[model samples]
Target: MGRVNTGPSDPTAPDHHEQGNPVTERVVAELVERSNTLGSDPRNTNFAGGNTSAAGTRTDPVTGGPVELLWVKGSGGDLGTLTEDGLAVLRLDRLRALVDVYPGEDREDEMVAAFDHCLFGKGGAAPSIDTAMHGLVRAAHVDHLHPDSGIALATAADGERLTRECFGDRVVWVPWRRPGFQLGLDIARIAEENPGAIGAVLGGHGITTWGATSQECQDHSLEVIRTAERFIAEHGRPEPFGPALEGYEPLPEEERRARAAALAPTVRGLASTDRAQVGHFTDTEEILDFLARAEHPRLAALGTSCPDHFLRTKVRPLVLDLPATAPLEQVVERLGELHVRYREDYRRYYEEHADADSPPMRGADPAVVLVPGVGMFTFGKDAKTARVAGEFYVNAVNVMRGAEALSTYRPIDESEKFRIEYWSLEEAKLRRQPAPKSLATRVAFVTGGASGIGRAVAERLAGEGACVVVADLDAEQAEKAAAEIGSADTAVGVACDVSDARAVTRALEQAALAFGGVDLVVNNAGLSISKPLLETTERDWDLQHDVMAKGSFLVSREAARMMTTQGMGGDIVYIASKNAVFAGPKNIAYSSVKADQAHQVRLLAAELGEHGIRVNGVNPDGVVRGSGIFAGGWGAQRAAVYGVEEKDLGAFYAKRTILGREVLPEHVANAVHVLTSGELSHTTGLLVPVDGGVAAAFLR
Candidate 1:
């Protein structure tokens, strides 16, 4: 058996963490431990839905001066098995100072300032919505998540009443607010209101808890949720109702486009002036109800997104008018009448609720206009805004219909809507400096390009208007993939063992000569050995490392030199594996070499980043339909070691993924594009796991 490396013996029985208190260590440990329950947590019924974070000051190994706001859980990460660094670091004091400013004075400028300060030095991930919220908590540990049980309670009628009954004396409740800086500030106010309050629940939102320790906070989260669930069972369900007009169908593209365009100007004039903002269009409820009974039952019930989305969608669109322009003044007059009724109803709602505060609301402008003959138009400030608005409306429609099956759909109240609409934190999030898509005119050379992820990335780059060269050890296969992609520059297939210096050099020359110059390079050709470490010889280690590790270096070095000479920056990508972090039994050499491969990318990044060249790696776990890496029929050997019949091989891998689906070559290719494209301009020296939550368990 291979011995796992143990660290050096302690000179004395000193604390493992010099800076943390015993209690702090215990809290962090418990939080870390409880969080491990995330993937398997009954609360996350969907594959990846929950999140977590931590905040504290620590002596930096390099800078040592009380580094603040060390790390927080990021988007697309499961808090369950997360480690310290998995959370991105942001300066808390800097963020808190940002929140204190009167953001409303110049919303956009202040918001962007927050993004610049909070996410400036972050890596692969961006700062999540809860960043400012965590900043306000100012606790050593903080955790957040959208728990189903809590949502179920928050979504019910009289949620506040029920909430008061359950933890009336325990958790403080903040009215609904859009997540981000506004929500953070709201939570801070609640925290201030109740000095010793352990946690707070955002109405129609979710629950948040903070403690000096991770475990305390985590336990608090669980307890608060359980309390809400108990509160609901005792209080009664919302009134039952039937869904309104549910039949719907997606329109033909030509018709849809024309309709959207015709209605576009109307929506823009009524809302924000962003034409790229398109709205969700659907037939009248009467027509939809008729469609529900059609043979295409599945296609008939398409609906919108969630309840809060009503703010963007209005209660529903008036599906009248055709070919769209009914004079702006006349349209405005009719819309004005409807707006008056909406305002009256809203005012009455607040007046009836004795405990609520009253404020003049932004007039209800129909965000989405459905012109029968034309289609639907969405209003927003930009393309992103339009898309989000459309999606939200769709989600709202869906939630409304779904809840009708059981009861009323829950919508966040006016206070929450107002808070989010003008939320400084959200504005800050929008200010995030987007990654540049600079590879538009660049050239890329990829190895193992005949098929699988290599081919996919090449095709994606080519699609994005880049000149790509598809190279492989197998010239025939490479040429085949090149032809499939049909690049005008034509991806030339050159045969060469990436491991051989002479072969790599020749391939580089051919690729450079064909493309004129190379700006992007993917060292994707690699292999894996499944033998145990004891069985893994010096030769096995040398062979795997040479191609996966050293081959990467040789290719990067040549690409770097070309980019330098051309006076343009470049990028280098690597195809790594999940085994790098979680080495499966018996594959010792493959794992160690893969780990070193990651290190190599980081090292290259540090060296080349100064030259305007970015180097990064893609670590994919269980890439099905990938290249020959797992081919050649190893079923017999795998069966022998696994002690199962060859037929069980599929199940073995399937059971390992949290998503219950195999990773695809296309998935890996997407990550490659994101990193190589301008979308992640400042991103470098990063390792991305394209495995759907596999590393969560591995690192745990």
Candidate 2:
């Protein structure tokens, strides 16, 4: 292998000099462009794992004196969507001084404090722990990342020699060392010794490349990755392992999704804590292929691809069996035992490696879960974090494959992993996160959530920190609603016709799978028909009953079943109608079914009370906007009956109510939220009227 110039020759890549001040424009712009390009690709970086920096001169705010400044990626920031404010600026001289005076003991804490203290101005973000290392390099720009290709070679036993063979003297090699002031000093020493080297590969960690300009820095990083890829392709190639499932036929798409949904709750329950949001991931080809490997269980337990991955993925993944045909009860029992063993193993691992100074590990729960037959599942405090963990593990699998193909897969030892895992700096990043919202760890499922009252409820629940599954008759609308309710991996969209029992069951499965389990369910899907008793056709009556009455029964039944299996008490809120309590002229079909649905809630509450499940109903009237019924010409029909114009119908209902306030979709959502929030924990089997105080609808 030989060093080859693979600089920015692609015409399609975005130019970095498009925006910013003249002084730092090229450097800053190039950093942003390259960072986004690298960060956007999961193979390059996951979440906020990578760091980049640029050196420039800025006037000192305190003394108005010209000072050299290093802008480094800030802590807890994502590079793909980074902005100017995301980079923390520090005086280069102050950072270098810490290198000379800082004691090695408690280096992590001291370096973090020193970084915070050396901020160029008030309110500046904290620089990454690698900031000092970025300053030591003489280049105008620096890029540090944990790309899969680089990690594959970095974790190999002969990685150092191979790196030298690939790039000759173009890149330096740094032995594994815990990241802190000492690591920074070591990197500086290597760079000084090899003045001609443009980059350095840190064994068992990652790679760093620097240059006089942003373009050169990015080019060198890309070149390093290319050389590693080429070397792996030629020398270290794995024999063909055959197709992922050579003997077994793949499950149909629908069946696969259904199986995932059924098994998701078990993973979620095992991974969750009292205070964590705990989002889940179970559908990906990479995960399936990894699971299909004959040595999957052993290979997955080897370790993470790199040390930085230990912070998110842990030392090894927790492997479990999830056959598609496994009984739910059996699956639950096995998962319970697996969880216990996993925790014990984690405890033992920590005990064996921990020093007297190490802080007690917070929790021993597994972040990545490998389900042999079904696929892989990753858990996090929220959807985005869970997805990030999944991404890292997927990349880990690829890196491991590459390493095994070339040579024995060799990662940092457990002691080194413990150092990074329990490092105060990494832990502080998590600590600095703001307190979670009220419904942080809760999961909710909402039917008809694509729009109207359902959509409002979904959004409100998500805002309060619940992972939500938006189910509707329209798949496109459901997906859109889920996207709008976005918090990476937290919300999912499923097309579900509530009246269909199979569809309802599938939707519930999806809810369980995506969020580990469902805590709150909103039965808000229904249609309205206005017809006199004498004029009502059998089809009209059946359609109304199937949806409002039978639909509620099916959804509630499935939700209760899952909740029962989870052994956790949950809330079920049914969206009934004010007309259910008060008779409305020419509305027999809609009103009668709604009344039946309301009574069903009381019956369910009575039956489920023993299981600690609460069933309640919300009676909302005259929700003119954001209502499917209203948008489907019900507003005009109701207005005609009242001898008012279509546009005036909303006002007409408002005047008829005792409070004379407009009843909106949001008003209904607030009532649903209250019931699901367990604020009225002691109360159940009741209906809350959210119709601006309708007298007849009031509970007697």
Candidate 3:
């Protein structure tokens, strides 16, 4: 690293962080506001894909003298949600001193720890790898971003000449270099060497811009991106990817979605061969167009250039070789063969790169998979990770388009990519994440999840870290329930009448699309028509059994197929009622249906045990409060039958139990969690009673 001599610190600098320094406070606030404006749009930067900084004078509490402070985005934070607390506060004078003892690129890892000594106070947040970039730059504000249009130019074949043509003298081109303390020093020199330059394109990486003001820096960053985009548009071929394959032409929307749903579980399973993973599906025009073209296989094989994208999506995506129009059965079978080859190739890549110091081959499985016609599916430890991985790949696809238009898409070599993928610093960050919830990475599909016991079950499972699907007859109510559970990515709602086969399949498909495939299924959709045998019409009998009995049957069958295809063992819990065992008056239709479901649980458990599908039941007697059945007038009818007030029916049922406790939805939810909570992995096929000790319904 070339030594950059620093002058003595100015003790008389304005204290930006003074208790009453409004100007300094305004500057930091404006810095955050600029970051949000840029980060809010995916075009500006992908989620958590960039860092920004501002330099100002701050009062040193210990010395009572003014000092220059550098505030930059910290490690593991997204720019859009960045706050003052999210930035690392460092003494710029002390930071410049590190150039004297950087020890070169070979010892870069040690430099990260060395940053601790330069903290201005306790240090707002952990300093990121790009800290030196902001600190060494000779500007008041700096922005380092990875926009698609900019990276497309960065990875072009003749990028140096093209960058000159694109931005003239304002934006310069720097050769490919792995990011580190030295890379920052290199950028600093480039900025100093070139006068009247606003930014420089980091070859094979991204773009960096600087300005005397925060607004100017932000403007330069956006202008660089928009300029490159316009250049690519003007000079690039209309169809850089070439003609689409015969059978790979983008499938019709409905068919495309159906095929993606059918294949998601198998794909998710393949990705999880190394560790359990959730899946995310995407079929944007760009991704589909790329996959349909002749160049996709070759381009995808080259892998992504930017480290931010590669870390999330891995070295390269695993591609499906057969045509999209092939028979579903044939394609599914062929996928297995191709998957074997992909695994072998990935393992070889690891063997080719590993050394004594390299982290153990993290996993051979690819994080992203591309299928022509159908679309892209990405997997990770949880829903958010999976979704974000897809977003990063979209960035990768955009980079490819821009690069191909300029010339050949030339990304950084694979050897350097391997080093970063297994970098020790990244491993440390993973270790720092809080322990996962009990049901982390598991997907739970809850039927009738809109209200009552089903809603409670969904909420409880979500709290334990399971991604929930609120499937119910009421679409709006289902969405409401899902919203309360968590964010759209964490929990989703779908209208599903479990008794309809097509509707049931579509609901499960949504699950596969939203959070991979099902690991836990709650067959809880139900209704009741309390009537005596003579009064129970044929319609009444059919409706009751269709939901509880037939609906449970349909959901289990579809879930079993998905789970079996995934090859990951799963749990299925049926919410049977206490009436299944104990006969109740004027309840012929509802009681018989419950009895049918109770038996189905045991029968399926015995048969599906070979496939590692555990089936169980939760029998709750009088769940009246917040109960959809009660609210629908069942409480009045049951109260009339028991000779008690409508509201007192709950008390009447509770007094009958040995424990004298009214059964609530949460109580039933707890039983469901217990059955599938992994603590009782061996205890399946057993019916757990949540009826507060009803002897009549107790098993022998």
Give the per-residue lDDT of model 3 (tens digit) for 460-560: 99999999999999999999999988997789999999999999999999999898899999999998877778988999999988888999999999999
TM-score list, all predictions: 0.40, 0.91, 0.97
Q: Which tens-of-lDDT digit does each residue in 174-245 have in candidate 2?
A: 888776666666776787678799888888788888877778888888888888778778876554223454
**lDDT by residue for model 1 over 1-700, one digit each (tens)?**
1111112111222323324656335434554565666535645212233456555444445655544543566654556556554556666556666754635533533453465565425363556656666666646566665555555445555556555667875787777655656666677767766867778766665577777656677777888867755554455334222222222342454554443433333343344222112222334443233233222122112222222344445444433321223454565466445445544654554455423332333344445544432334454432334444544444343333333323344565544454544344534444564642345446688887777778888888777656678878788888878888874343567776888887886776665434445678988887766788689889888988888788887888777776665445678988887777885788888788888878888898999888788888888875545546655444445556778765665456667778666677788888998898877889899888877768453543
Q: What is the Å distance of residue 218 in model 3 from its true position?
A: 0.6
lDDT of each: 0.58, 0.78, 0.89
Candidate with maximal TM-score? 3
RMSD of 1: 21.5
Separate clash counts for every candidate: 22, 2, 1
Residue ranges of candidate 3 with Cα displaced over 4 Å: 5-17
Roughly what TM-score does model 1 have, to 2 decimal places? 0.40
- Candidate 3 worst ten-residue window by lDDT: 4-13
What's the residue-level lDDT of 456 in candidate 2?
92
Q: Listing every candidate in turn, what is its Cα RMSD in Å to the true structure after a full C-alpha superposition? A: 21.5, 5.0, 1.8
Q: Residue 661 in candidate 2 has what lDDT?
A: 89
For model 1, where is the 10-residue window of minimal lDDT?
1-10
Candidate 1, after superposition: displacement of residue 378 in Å? 15
